[model samples]
Target: MFGVGMSTAYARKLRWCTLNARFKDSAIVARPGAIRAGDRETFMKIVRFILALAVGIVIFSLTVAAVGAIGHGFYPPPAEFQQIGDRMSDAMRAQDQAAFERTQVELAEAMAAYLPTAPTGSFIFVVAAWITGAFVGGGVAAFVTSWGRRSVAMLVGVADVGAIILVSSLLPGPGWMPFVGIAGSLIAAFAAGTLVASGTRTKPSLSRKAAP
Candidate 1:
């Protein structure tokens, strides 16, 4: 009877306050559906990026094949040359130096047509093929990409550099040739990538209406 002033209305008010806070907290947190949707969107972006890289590599291979076809057409090896080459392979297998020299003379005669032509064209073609491939591939990667376009393009550039180094080691050309090839490949690829990335921008749709 002494604490009667602590009435039912005050007790009701305290209970309502506690319920309100719980509801507010629940609203502040994200729903599970929204979180799942966001994760799916991120996964899709990564998939598209992988596809873009694959397309770039395919484009590079096609460019190399096209350039190689041109070289094969321009300097077609003769049937006799093929036969001599086979015989030379047989000599090496049998460890016969005498037979190797005989085949070598025939091969020299067979390759006479190419001698006067000079190997400058072959060197130019190889370099041109690499440069063109890098440019085309990097451009494609950048064009297809929406995120990290420059990074993807750089990967293509580095791939071209790796290929150039491998071929240079096998062919053993002049000491300076690999440096030139690597520089040319990286420059062409990165430049094309930068161009493509920058080109995608369209001066943000003028948000405000033009003045009357």
Candidate 2:
């Protein structure tokens, strides 16, 4: 009888161990699935942000192109500058590095001379085009992303300012141009972000009584 009782206890203990092992195995499997689901969600958010940024950039480029075309039409470069530009293009097409470099130097010299003497209208147009692009592009980005998210829009604005700075540096524009571009782009970005953030707020109904 004692031997039989000992055998029964051992069997119960074994059964309990088996059940516990199964529970732990199920928990381990469930945890990995949860982690994978979370990771997928995070990845999707990242993808959405990237797509938004790309769209914003494309829009910004289009805006800049349209405004720049108008500016160019209004303030055509000097004949000499145009001639040098044509030469530069030809050199590039022909893959003539030496000629390209020489033409580039000539173009730089002409631009430096002309920019100093250029009318204020030209600079105004350049700055205006960039500022407008930044505002519109940043706003669009903010609209596409969540109302609470502004990083994408702010990045678009940063791109605008960076592009302007790069162009100015390469073409050697007025010393103040970079600073102005930075300031304008920053303000535009902030305005876009503020607009989006405000959109998320609920307006109180007129019928609601004032709090005591």
Candidate 3:
């Protein structure tokens, strides 16, 4: 009877041991899944943060451009055309070919003087406006679609080139300044898009099956 009792106790102990082992296995399996879920949530938060930063930069740029435009309109540049027209009027009135030729030289000088003087505050504002406008415009364009993004880049390039051409016609200087703005905008938009896309791709899919 003692031997039988000992056997029964051993059987009970074995059954308890089996249950405990099963419980430990279940806990171990559940831990990794919980950790993975936490990691995915953390990654998503990081992605959101990055998107917010990009959007903020774009908005800041637009604000700067708008302010610059308002200031420029209020304080217009020197009127080169009015002086030139006055000279031409005098030349026509005098009806002296020699005097008109001399007046033409003087008018040219006056026009040159009207051309943007270096170290002007307006120059700084213009630069800021171009840079900020490009960045904001490009970012908005990028958000539309992939094709729209590329189109934005191209459009910016063309617009900058056009501005440079237009400015060059009025004033003499290097025409490459606007190109720099275009390139900068394109690069910024590309970087923003790539970062956002990569972040999206790296995000874990919650619907995936957990490991056994």
- Please provide, for model 1 over 1-212, each residue's C-alpha lDDT reduced to its tens digit, 9 standing for 90 to 100: 54665777678889999999988877666577688899999998898788878888788878877886787577554577789999999999999999999998888666665444546666677777888888898889888877777777778878888988897765555565678778887888889888887777642434234434
lDDT of each: 0.78, 0.82, 0.58
Q: What tens digits encode model 2's per-residue C-alpha lDDT throughout 1-60?
A: 999999999999999999999999999999999999999988887777788788887887
Give the top-scoring candidate (TM-score): 2
Query: What is the Cα-based TM-score of model 2?
Result: 0.74
Error of 1 at 60 (Å): 0.8
Q: Please list all clashing residue pairs in model 2, or write none if there are none.
A: none
Model 3 residue 184 CA deviation (Å) reads 3.6
Query: Candidate 3 on 1-212: residue-level lDDT in tens?
Result: 99999999999999999999999999999999999999998887656544544554455456556967775676565566566667778878988688778777876677577544534555555655655555554455445432334444345434544554565566563345455545654565455455444444455553343434
TM-score of each: 0.66, 0.74, 0.39
Better of 1 and 3 by TM-score: 1
Q: Which regions in candidate 3 have their CA more than 4 angstroms from the true location?
A: 1-67, 70-76, 79-111, 116-118, 146-151, 173-212
